[model samples]
Target: MKYQQINKSLFETNRAKFTTKMKPHSLAVFNSNDIYPISADSTMPFEQHRDIFYLSGVDQEESILVLFPDCPKEKHREILFLKETNDHIAVWEGEKLTKEKAFETSGIKTVYWLQDLGKIMFEIMTQCDTVYINTNEHYRANVETETREDRFTKWLKNKYPAHAVAKSNPILQRLRSVKEPIEIDLIQKACDITEKGFRRILEFVKPGVWEYEIEAEFIHEFLRNRSKKFAYTPIVASGNNANVLHYVENNQQCKSGDLILLDVGAEYANYSSDMTRTIPVSGRFSERQKAVYNAVLKVKNEATKMLVPGTDWAQYHVEVGKLMTSELLNLKLLDKADVQNEDKEWPAYKKYFMHGTSHHMGLDTHDYGILTEPMQANMVFTVEPGIYIPDEGFGIRLEDDVVIQKSGEPNNLMKDIPIEVDEIESIMNG
Candidate 1:
């Protein structure tokens, strides 16, 4: 991992929180993600499953974490199974985590090789009455691939059919949504890295620069800052391309007068920061562009304030829609008649600003959170409001990650990053 080792206390706390919610005599298991294949012998980069990383801080493939607080044998209560490492394997690949190293990485003392998983699991399965299986239950998830966790779940169920099955998603969804102090710091580091990348591109951007060039600049800054990669697939849409909400074909030349919509962020130590900033290709927004940009910024600022404790996620968006509607009206994009006659299902504001204003942001870009529940303190959310105008030949989006506070407004993590038009223009021109 490019990022420094996280404090084991954070993982220790996370495991405690999870285990406290588990049913008595239940054991919860988390598996590391597989190194997916691109073709023969060539594979995609390995990304540890966020659940295992959250609970055990084990950031490697072919790893497992088992939490059994009620186990009769004290050593077997919390265990880690990792791929065995030796001198020969170290020469071929890099140094994999040894048993000692695993203990240091995760706070758990009982560590075993992956080869012994079946034997150990069989022993534990007999002792426990219930098995907790991890599953992807995020609202935004549309997974089609069978993950390593899924295979493990199937195997466990087949091997121990009599054991009561329980889902770990509900518990994880609640626990992971709220940030611990250490987790908040890690996310802040990611946001700080993103700010550097954004600032770097502000000076580099100009007429005739390709969108991909801007993407390259962000990655360069991120890697140098210990960020492994983007939090998600970056969107470097220039000009009309921004009208396509998820446009990622960053191949076009940025015209002199066109705007570039940059929906990008950096990931540090598996934590994600999501940010979207649209700026002028020529380092100066035109009169119309400035007006639209400020309007979107206004909506973002107002929406962020609504992310306080006890705020309902669905109602927050409705209120944000109202804010956007007012902005669209002021922009002359929507009239009184348009709003009055608009369908309740899809508001008139949808014509210009369609996507949701916010989503939970943390370990995953669209992190885990039960939207039906009220917002809580320390929960991180992204307030992103965009105005996509195909007729005007540009789109404007401004986003910031914020922590829900106990009182008043939420704290903006990207506060140090440039957002104002004058500030962005001054940095670019200076």
Candidate 2:
């Protein structure tokens, strides 16, 4: 891990929050992500499952966390299972976490090796009547590949057929949505690293620069500041590429008059910071580019104001669509006829601005938050509004990470990062 150790108190608080809602005499288990394969004898980088990482601050592979609120044995209530390491294994794959170190990292003294998982779980299963299983129940989830957690869930159910099964998604969705103080600090560090990358690109981006060069600048900055990598696949779309929405083929040369849409973020301590900024390739925006830029910025600003307590996610996006409609009307992108004749299901704003204005952002880029529930305090979100015009050969979007406050206005984490046309222009020219 490139990042520093997180304070274990945060995990302690998270466990307390989760256990408070668990049903009596129930045990919940979280599994680490499988180190996915590339081809023969090679695998992608290991990313700890966010749920496990949230409950226990262990950032390692082949780890497991068990939470049993009604355990007869006090020491077994919170336990960690790590991959045991020996001299030969240590030389090949590096040193794994020892029991004492796992205790310090997770604040859970009951630690065992992965090889003992079956016996330990078997003993604990006899004491509990109900088992809680984690699932991908987020609103945006569309998983195709079976994950490590999925396989464990299947085995646990079949092996313990007599036990009553429950879903952990509901409890976790609510708990993980709200950010702790420590969580907010880690997210801030990610945002700070993203800020550095953006500032560097403002100076590096010019006419005829390859789109991949801009991507390289961001990677360089993130590594220097201890970020493992981008929180998600970055979108360094230039010109019409930005209009494709998820376009990631950064192979084009950025032209002088074109606008580049940067939907990139950095991950520090496994927390994500999503940021989007559209800037001119030549350090000066054309008149039409400036018009669209300010319009998206306006929508982004007004949309973030709606992220307060009691606001519904679905209803909030509906309200944001209305805001975008008004801006598009002024931009002449949608005429009175287009507004009147458009289908009710898809508004006239869809012609120019198509995606949702905001999504919950944290551990995962599209992190956990039940969409049906009302918004709550301390929930972090990204307010991103874009106007993509493929015909015009340009696109613009402005995004910022914000913390929804208990009252009044929400706090903008990217407030110091350049967003305004004047602010971005000044930095590019500096």
Query: What are the root-mean-square deviations of the candidates from the true structure over C-alphas?
Result: 0.8, 1.0
> What digit string (tens of lDDT, one per residue) describes model 1 on residues 135-193?
89887789999999999998888889999999999999999999999999999999999
For candidate 2, lDDT tens digit of each residue in 238-317? 88898988888889999888889999999999999999999998898889999988888888888888999999999998
Question: Which residue pairs overlap in candidate 2's backbone?
Answer: none
Ten contiguous residues minimizing lDDT sum, candidate 2: 134-143
In the predicted model 1, the residue pairs found to clash are none
| Top model number, TM-score | 1
lDDT of 2: 0.92
lDDT of 2 at 252: 92
Off by over 4 Å in 1: none
